[model samples]
Target: MIESAYIHIPFCSHICNYCDFAKVLYQKKWIFNYLDALKKEIQLNYQNELLKTIYIGGGTPTALDLEEFKYLLEIISTLNKQKEYEYTIECNVESLTEEKVKSMKQYGVNRISIGVETFHKHHLKIMNRHHTKEQVVEAILLLKKYGFQNINIDFIYALPNETIEEVVSDLCNFLKLDIPHISTYSLMIEPNTPFYLNHIKTIEEELDFSMYEKICRTLKKNGYEHYEISNFAQPGYESKHNLAYWNNAFYYGFGLGASGYIPEIRYTNTRNLTKYCNGEFCFNQEKIDFKTKMENEMILGLRKLEGVNLIQFKQKYGKEMDSIFPIRQLQKEGKLQVHNRYLRIPEEQLYLSNEILMQFIDT
Candidate 1:
């Protein structure tokens, strides 16, 4: 009953300083071989289920040349797609050409998430991202010209030395676009990324918190629902594929470094390209137990603004929330509350949700 799949293309024309995803410079030889491996992996694992959503993420999936992008699409065409499926691809404005956009349309791509980290040229250079503001404008205009309206633009705030004014400026530009979806993330200098290697530090906590509050307030005022902690969407445009993950549903993850979840198992593909291409797709997997599943159910479900459904949880897991976890304690602490039958974190306390969620870890 897996209804979603995430395909990864670990090839980028230029590596951004903050990115640590499994990726390498776009090499023609590697691209062809990787496509072969990806196709084989899908053929072997896909059970012909009519997937409701398929997300093609990167290393910039649109970085491929015109012919290579077409071949990749052709490979994806073999999947059993639902009548009204959501097929999304991650793209960078510089490489997402007109031909690629048309090819995506022909292959049933209904959504395109662009990597416009920030609108400021100085911030772009600071993050080692090459696309200019004008390029992003052209890219969006082009996508709209092709009748693709379900678009999302990613933004990263809390950069080293980043100010609230800069973040406000970026949001101002984003609001003008009138796009349906937006995903914003705070800067975390994870180990192994160029930012980490160069000793980049995050912004002050107060500023970071302020930036988050600003983003939430602005997007909500502009008629976007704060569906998730980092995602805002206009009613019907929330990413179905991502919602699958937060809902604790199963999905297939294909390609090097991709992760997937089945009925009781979660697996991640190997990051080593050589091993991945040689048919060693998954390197780590864990069989999930009932206790683990329940914990995951709470942790993942609580991420949504609406939180988890009480009766649905009992029906699915055969246990009430109070019987399985300390719901009353969280409720007493004012961290979680029930609203219209849904147990959710209060809007003001969402920023501290991680601390509250940790209490249910092993209960």
Candidate 2:
């Protein structure tokens, strides 16, 4: 049973230089039409299963005016949610308002993930993000006031010319907010983004590695669990929505540019706004064959700190994991290990997880 769904709202008040997601400048004229199309898309695809998690991500879901935002929530209310469901909405500090927060609270939004990439002015300027540190604090306080505490803030490190001190400072500021979850990312200059268009380069590989190490160490020291590679959360605060993805579980993805996995099919919606608004949702899809399914199970399962369960793997696929891949070889190389019956990358080697994961690609 598909137990999760991700809804994308592809409109933002301002575009960040590093963003490559499918999004458009927020326009009043398109809001109604886009939301209408989104509602239709959900109605057509949703199977009315009792979802355990529903994440409403962006292009800043908070960018919508109060009426539009509430309308969007109304549409989402149609989805059947378990009694103890986790409903998350991504917000930007500049766009999150008291009215919206109250509306979200009323509509059963239990989690709020904010895009507070950095607290440094220079870094924010470089990224074309306009929220001040003051605004971020106020937004957090407001969310807390509304009895919403399952908060998460995104952090970006390893920017061009970034220093260790700056990274430390940002970490300090983030800790002060006392939020439970943080998702850290190293900046990647994807093609077509302003950073790539402006010929910007990423920080040196060694420095990037060092910064990631610092983040992991510091967060761990502060009583946060490095549960997934790039995510840290206070115990009991991990993102259930994201865990669905890492588990390779089936989920419905709705709206422009969203992707979904259902049973044996994985598909992405059309990124073109014109096409999406015209009800042309699917852009591409691929059938998951048996070999691909096993590969995906291994690749996605290994992302957790506890790794994959060998017994569960055998029971699900009817084959031993070592019989299918180079698990024994990787364990011999000290890159992978079995702890308490869970196969995982050693904590010390997690920074090289991408490289280790690549070894499973064709096996």
Candidate 3:
């Protein structure tokens, strides 16, 4: 059963240079129509089953004005919530005010993830991010004041001209916030983004590795565990919604440009706003076969630091992981190791995980 749902709000107040998510500028009239369509889509897709987690992400979910946010929250509140429900909403530091934070609290939101890509002014300007460092601090303080302790802050490193010192500075500032969760990312220049349009090149691989190492070292020195490749969290605070994806569990994805996996089918909604507002929800879908499903399970499972549970994997797929894949060969190559019945990438070899995971592909 799908115990989680992800809702997308495809509107941003300002377009960032590096963002390629399906989003448009926020307009009141468009938002109204979009919400109307979103309600229809949810009503049709949701089975009124109890959901354990609900995540609202987007260009910036908090970019919606107060009234629009309330309406969206009201619609979401109708979902059958579980006793251990974890409802999260993404917020941009610039647009998330005290009132907005309070409104989320009033609507049963227990978690908030803020996009504070970097604390450095130069990097912020290059990325076209408008949130000031002061705003981020104030937002966190406000969330804390209102009893919202389950907070997450995002940081990006290895920008166009970022240096080791700069990345460390960003990490230091991030640590100072005392937030429970931190998600760090090394910059990737994806196609169709402003950075790609401007012909931006990625930083050197060595530098990127250095930044990743620093993040791992610093966060580990503190109380945070590197649970996922890009996520660090204090114990008991890992993102349940995100883990549902990494575990290859089923979930419902609603609103424009969202994707979901339901049993054998994986689907993505249309990115075209006009078509989505007209009630055409899905743009692409694939009926997954057994082999494909196992491949997804391996790829997604390896993302977690604890790796795939061998017994659980056998129970779910009814096949031994060693029989289906060359696990013994990978162990000899020093890329992967099975420890305590969990097949995981060695801590020192994590940076090269992509190369190691490729060997498991049946093709």
Candidate 4:
């Protein structure tokens, strides 16, 4: 009953200083080559099943010019899908033109995720993002003008030296936009990213925690549900595509650096752009072990505010919660609770979610 797909686009007009995703500056010759390789990969990876959701994400999907975009869409729309499948594409403010927005609507994309990172010009400059604040506004307006109603604007807090006051201000600005959904992320400095290599500091842990609390309060006050730790949405606007990932549902992923799970096997495509461009790197898969699979089920389920359904877990895994998870101990420690038949991590404990989730990891 699970149906989803993920496509990774490895080209970006310019790389962000904080980005660690596998990507390269655009070279037109590889455009057609990548399209061919991606099509072949899809053909090799999945059969025609009803696709409930498809997400085209990466180095900036909107980086492709109009002609190239049409070609890419033509290749992607071939996935087997139920009527009314949700199709999401990630875009950069600078790359999403009015023409591109219209063309996306024409091509059947139903969701648009724009990377807004932050509204402060100083933060954008420090992050080395190529777009200005005006571009972000313009992009959203264009999408709305083209009748694209489902929009998700992504933001990041906890930048080095960011104050809690500043974080609240940023959230207020985004709230004013009337966007349907917002994804707010903490700044994690990954090794090998430009920021990490240059030794850029992250926000102080105390300040970061304060910032997170500030965001939760502001979003709730603005009538957005803090459904997932990182996602805030107006009622009924949660991201269906990403929910598939968090719920550990089976999905087919194609293109460079995409990861997916189908039935019992988990797979990750090659990180090297050259390997991904040749159709030889799509099926590097590893079969899931009992412990790894169980850990995934426990951890991924905890990402939602509603948490794991006890009855559904038993139904899916053929095991009782008392036998599998340390649910009782966590409840005693005030980290988690079972309401009705669902186990949920407490809201305040969410910022330290990794610690709570790891308690259930099977060795």
Candidate 5:
């Protein structure tokens, strides 16, 4: 059964230079119509299963005004949730308000993931993020004041012309928030983004690697678990919604530009807002064949620190993992390892995971 759902709210007050996600500037004129379309889409797709997690991600879900935000929450309330469900909403410091926090608390949103990419003023300007460090601190304090402790802040490292000290300083500022989760990402200049259009270059490969290493060391030393490749969290605070994706589990994705996996089909909604609002929900879908399923099993499952479970693999696919792929060979090359019956990429080799995961393709 699909136990997770991700809803995308594709409206932001300001677009970040590095963002490539499907989103548009917030317009009050479009808010009600978009929410109505979102409600229709969810009603059509959701099977009424009790979901363990529901993540409302962005283009800054908090960009909506209080009434609009509450309307969005009302639409989400239709989903049947488990007894201990985790409901998360993405926020930006500038858009998040005290009234919205109270609304989220009342509507059962237990998790808040903020897009505080960098605390450095120069980096913030470069990314077109306009929030001050004080605003971020105030947002966290406000969330905490409302008893919302399962907070997460995104951190970006390895920007163009960024220094190691700057990265470390950002980390220090994040530490002061004392939140439970941090999702760190190395800057990638994707096509069509403002960064790519402006010819912004990434930092050197070696320096990027060093920054990743430093982040891992510091977060680990400070009692955070490097549970996934790009996620660090205090124990018991891991993102259940994201874990569903990495585990290759089925989920419902509602709203424009969202992608979902359900049973044998994986689908993405239309990126065109006009098309989506007009009820043209699906843009593309691919049937998951057996070969592709097994490949995804390896590629996605190995992302976790514990890796994939060897026994579960056999039980699920009715074949030994080594029989289907080059598991034994990768193990011999020290790219993979078996620890406590879980097959995983060794911690030291995780940075090269993309290269290693490619081997499973077409195997």
Candidate 6:
């Protein structure tokens, strides 16, 4: 069952030097045409069932003008569901406005994810991000004023030239907010990004790993649950929309560069904006075999802090997690711990989880 929907809006006001997400510079005419095509696509795939969640992420959804934003929201409001579902909209800090937030609230959006990557102006400029810290504060306050209660602030840590003190200071800035959710990630120098081209020196491996642990401890001390690899939420405020993805549930993905998984197939659309905009859709689809599915179950399930449920895996796939897996091996090596029915990597091994999880795959 397609219980979740992920819609991509591939336009941004300006490409941040560090961003690698599929996006093109904002053009008024391009947006109008692209939006029309997007709506047409949505109508064609519109399922008249109550979805469990809907996530509207983008290069920067807030970059659109009030009218364009409204047009997009009005189109998505057509979702027919049995109950109120989680509807999340990602917004850029500088572009968010009170009116835009109000439009989202009226259109049934229950959560607003603001990209406040960091709280330092110098770090912002260094990253080539255009938003000011004060602007993020304004956007957050605006969302609250518009009667939205569930707000999630996205933070990035461990950037080049970042020190432990600086990271903790950034956390302090985020802590001042009343928001219930925050997602943090170590800034990596992705292969094709400008940061990589400029040879931006990332933090030391050990230091970066230490920072990750510190964040978990601090956030937990501040009364948040470290639920997933990159997510922390106050009790009962975890992102349900992302949870569906983490759970490997079927989701409908729309717009160019988006990916969808239904039944045995997983596919991603073309990344070429021109080709996608020209109505020539490209999909890299693959049928997942049993071996692949089991591998995914092991790797993705381990991403959750609570790890995989042995009984649940057996019920879903008709095999014990430890039977065809090396659970005892990982435990013997001290990389993983088996508690009750869940097998999870130790908190200290989280940064090296990719290395640990790879052991479950068939080489």
Worst 10 residues of 3 by lDDT: 354-363
Error of 2 at 113 (Å): 0.2
lDDT of candidate 2 vs native?
0.95
**TM-score against truth, every candidate:** 0.99, 0.99, 0.99, 0.97, 0.99, 0.96
Give lDDT tens digits, candidate 2, residues 120-238. 89989999999999999999999999999999999999988999999999999999999999999999999999999999999999999999999999999999999999999999999
TM-score, cand. 6: 0.96
Task: Give, for candidate 2, the lowest lDDT window spanning 10 residues.
Answer: 297-306
Please estimate how well model 6 matches the true structure, expressed as its whole-model Cα lDDT: 0.83
Best by lDDT: 2
Model 3: per-residue Cα lDDT over 1-363, one tens digit each: 989999999999999999989899998889889988999999998999899999999978999999899899989988889999999999998888788888899989999999998999989999999989999999899899999999998888999989999988888898899999999888889899999999999999998998899899999999999999999999999999999999999999998899999877999999999999999999999999998888888888898999999999999889999999888888998878998999999888999989888877875
* True lDDT of residue 341, candidate 6: 82
* Stretch of 10 with least lDDT, candidate 6: 75-84
Per-residue lDDT over 1-363 for candidate 1, one digit per residue giving the tens place of the 0 to 100 score: 899999999999988898889899998888888999999999999999999999999898998999899999999999989999999999999998999999999999999999888887888898889989999999999999999999999999998898999999999999999899999999889899989998988988888889999999999999999999899999999999999999999999999999999878999999999999898999999999999998998899999999999989999999999998899988999999999899998989888889988988987
Off by over 4 Å in 5: none
Off by over 4 Å in 6: none
lDDT per residue as tens, model 4, 1-363: 559999999899987888888688888888888888888888886788889999999888889989988888889878877787789999998878777878788879989999998888898898888787788778778888888889999999888788887788888789877899999989989899889998999978888888888888888998999889899999988999888888888998788888889888898888876777766775478999877887888799899998989999888788887787788888999999888889999898898899999898874
**Colliding residue pairs in candidate 2:** none
The CA lDDT at 12 in model 3 is: 98
Count of clashes in candidate 5: 0
TM-score between model 5 and native: 0.99
RMSD of each: 0.8, 0.6, 0.8, 1.3, 0.6, 1.4
